[model samples]
Target: MKFVNVRNAVALALAAAFMFGATGCAGETERIESVQIPGVWTGAGGGRVEFGDDGRFELSGIPSDAVVFSFIDPPPKGEKVSGQGTWSVKRKGSIVGLIYDSTGSFAEGGEAGTLGVADGGDSPKLYFSTSSDREYGYEIHKSG
Candidate 1:
């Protein structure tokens, strides 16, 4: 009986650790010069900003000035909330992994995803996934 109880406790602890570690924004990698859009950039059809390290971002279309998970602790409703945290680059097949803060919260936290940097003729265009698997994304160009 004692062994059973100890085993259960260990299992529970492992589960909790797994969940906690699972919640993160992105990973860390070598820095690469990406697009920097100073102005506001919305998502596709206005769902939410996918991924970018520039300006305030939100999922509800509400504008903000805070960068890297807006200063608002709880975050506002409708506005999914997003901000630019530190990120690095890693090569995975044809896609590049943009690893930001793993512990970040809000739109930029509790998740690990990717954003494709497509060539926009003059500059590289940015597209990020909205869902965990990265089904849809938004197009953003470098702000001159």
Candidate 2:
């Protein structure tokens, strides 16, 4: 019968292209308005955060276990500790807490000084915490 109807029409077109590629990789998340977060942000190891609408903020290469530096235990790696600070944005519906300026807490998150924002369907994400009861974190994006 015509080769089993052409192999069932190629397995129903490969099962409708794998269900539309898994619904475009499960993408659906939107709501990040703190003025949509300032700008410049990139970190995977290189680090970079420059958010300033007026609240002021700046950090480079952050990775000293997410900054807990004090009297020094060899703690100095946010590219020699960020030198500009002052920021605030605490929301709970879509979660956007980034309250810096205290030498630490740029993603400690939820209910402790704060630092966490997400919606990276293609941009926007900043949450860095190597662990300090905040569980663990590291997700920085949004640059260009």
Candidate 3:
């Protein structure tokens, strides 16, 4: 009887350990916002964009909706164009790429290289650069 009881106790302890190990302390979807993007960034052609974790987005000093984008900038306040698409990230060393679909009133959608993100208070702002290097940088503000 003693041997059987010890065996059962050991089995229970092992099972509990396995369960805890399988379920980590934090969920995978829980995004740990790191100091990656936050400050102001320039975009294509003298365009200015700001990002805040406080749930606000401004384009050319006008509040705007969170429209999906591929390469083009979000419609500048009162533009008929509305961008809808998906965005993915590819990383290599200190560089990142943002690829997306330019659906809805866009010319063509494809892969684009990510320049860098400026880490700021609460939210990190995403930035994009042009191949010509002459056009102003583009900023990606966070959406609520």
Which model scores highest in lDDT? Answer: 2
Whole-model lDDT values for every prediction: 0.37, 0.50, 0.36
Candidate with top TM-score is: 1
Model 2 TM-score (2 dp): 0.24
CA-RMSD of model 3:
18.8
TM-score of 1: 0.37
Candidate 2 ranges with C-alpha deviation above 4 Å:
1-40, 43-60, 67-118, 135-139
Report, for all candidates in order, the number of backbone clashes.
5, 1, 16
lDDT of 2: 0.50
Once superposed on the true structure, which residue ranges of model 1 sit more than 4 Å away at CA?
1-78, 92-110, 131-136
lDDT of 2 at 60: 68
lDDT: worst 10-residue window of model 2: 105-114
Displacement of residue 81 (Cα, Å) in model 1 is: 2.1
Worst 10 residues of 3 by lDDT: 23-32
